[model samples]
Target chain A: MHELSLITAMMDLILKDAQSRGIRKITRVELKVGEFSGAYPHALREAFAVASRATPMEEAELVIEEVPAELRCRECGAVFRPSETGWACPSCRSQNVLLQGGLELEIQSYHGRDGDVGQGRSRQGYSSGEQEES
Target chain B: MSVKVVVGKDILAVNRKRAEDLRARFKQMGIKVVNMLSSPGAGKTSILEATIPRLQKVRAAVIEGDVATTRDAERLSHLGIPLVQITTLGACHLDASMVWKALEEMDLSRVDLLFIENVGNLVCPASFDLGENLRVVVLSVAEGTDKPAKYPAAFLSSQVVLINKMDLVPYTDFDLERVLGEVRAMKPDMKTFTMSCRTGEGIDRWAEWLEKWVRESQ
Candidate 1:
């Protein structure tokens, strides 16, 4: 499905990040997927495997943090997460709750060797927004 | 060995930002953009084809989105209007970034009305905004009337619900009243139009309403 496309986009960012830090190999890639985002994690992993072949992230481990569904009550100022069934604010018990968050997907960080680390191989402070890529 | 990272950023937030920006641009240009969404085989393309003839007087352009086909654009091209085809490769829904790229490629200077036909799906498309003035959801009777109840988000977010394939109502057992009730349950004030692109029945009312809305928005 679209997971493959999303996986490709993620890999593009990861590869770019990995190359920028002069990293030889990627150990792990942390990601946060939201509940309402409709991204299938299993499919994404499968897509990642295909997209990561022969790259610095060939053996990269994907760590996904699934964010659950959350809603905000319109009647009351109560914010809560939805249960297994449908959306009903847990705090104020209102059905007229608007969805607030949990729909997210991001590349958190990666662990790998960034060339020689001076006296000690220290972890690099890597972030997508902080880096500019052409 | 091991690393723990926290990425609390929202991926869709980026798209939403772009969609908002596009909406602002559309408003400034006085373009009445309509982002149309529906399930596969829901008559979205057909409705667009039907709507184009009635929009002859208006300077309208179509931005067709699909997984990997230019057929929809080809269909609209027959109407002799500016059309841009966006192939998503494999994405289920069309996001704002792709739309921004497509919009940049299209001739938007003289366009009064812009129609963006999203990839056919009632689920994923609801979560993404394509910077349209109105999000119209098409529901054909052949698909069943219970769709509004099952997929409330699509119905709730839509400004107009075009109930298409009304001519097939004779063959199918779709309850028009029940579908209307379901849509009203979620959105009590939603406007709906029932028509068939095949027979071109009841298309004028929809076209008239759309024209009025476009004029008002401009």
Candidate 2:
């Protein structure tokens, strides 16, 4: 499955990030998987288990957040989730709509073992766009 | 005393960056690359087989991707055009790195058009950008009409869609109108070509359009 390759590539990133931060053990990995991103959550979890075997992230828990697919109406600028009746906008019935969301695939954060909150560490190679410490 | 640190990195950011770099390289080199994606047995190779002979006016090459076979490369190499095969062994899609590596094995200096035939899958192939000038999704009549709706990502990101196996449309229950309707729902301006390689029904039109694209890229 493609999930296996995806998982392997993700682990490589995780390992590289962990190494840079001098984090020996990863407690958890937080990810966001959009509904339209084409990666099934269950399949990703299964692939993670198989890909992380005997690795530094083997004991890590995988946490995922699902984002709903959203569309924007071209005619009226209406933002709405996918409709059951059709893809027509709820605010304005327009077939000329564009996808605005549900294609996100991001690794938001990770919990590293035995690290202090504010001060105790080496130069943690934290490479996230959001520098907010969870 | 575990610390929860915010990384906020796109998981695909690295791959996307690589693809972007490759895109820049292609642009600087003035190579028109096409990434063709489809489901297994959707006639990607067959389309190339039929289209290449007619593309004599354009200098073309192909990089074939598959899970575990070089048969496709073997087939295209016989055409006497520069072609290479990247067998993923078990991976379902071709990523930017694989293509970047494949480039080192071939000579693309005088290549006007480069077609990368991705692994035959509707889902994962859409996620990875392989630095192509155009993205073409091929769907055959035998695959049914609901594919565009079911696999919106592939159809949504494509520039031109090739409706293959039209010769079998009369024999199968596939509805061309329904498929096109769904394709329009995803992308209103997507260019489409309906043809069957078995009968060479609409290859000439496709070849002309592709030749125009190649010329425009140059």
Weakest 10 consecutive residues of candidate 2 chain A by summed lDDT: A124-133
Tell me the tens digit of each residue's lDDT in model 2 across A1-134.
Answer: 57776677677887787666666788899888888888988999999998888988899999999988888989999888875444667776667889888887888888876544345554544335222344
Task: Give one digit per residue, the lDDT tens place, for model 1 in B102-182.
Answer: 877888888899999999988778767888889999999989867865565567678889999999998999999878865
- Segments of candidate 1 deviating more than 4 angstroms: A14-25, A67-95, A100-134, B1-5, B12-28, B67-69, B87-105, B123-128, B146-159, B176-191, B199-202
Report each candidate's C-alpha RMSD, comma-separated, in the order given.
5.2, 2.2
Could you list the chain B TM-scores for each candidate?
A: 0.94, 0.96
Best by lDDT: 2
Residues B1-218 of candidate 2 have per-residue lDDT tens digits of 56666777777777888999999988887888999999999999999999998985788999999999999988788789889999998888999999999999989887888999999999999999998889999999999878876777888889999999999988999988877866776788999999999999999999989999899768
Q: Which residue segments of model 2 deviate by more than 4 Å?
A: A83-86, A90-92, A116-134
Q: Which candidate number maximizes DockQ?
A: 2
Pairs of residues at least 3 apart in sequence or in different chains that clash in candidate 1:
none
lDDT of 1 at A63: 81
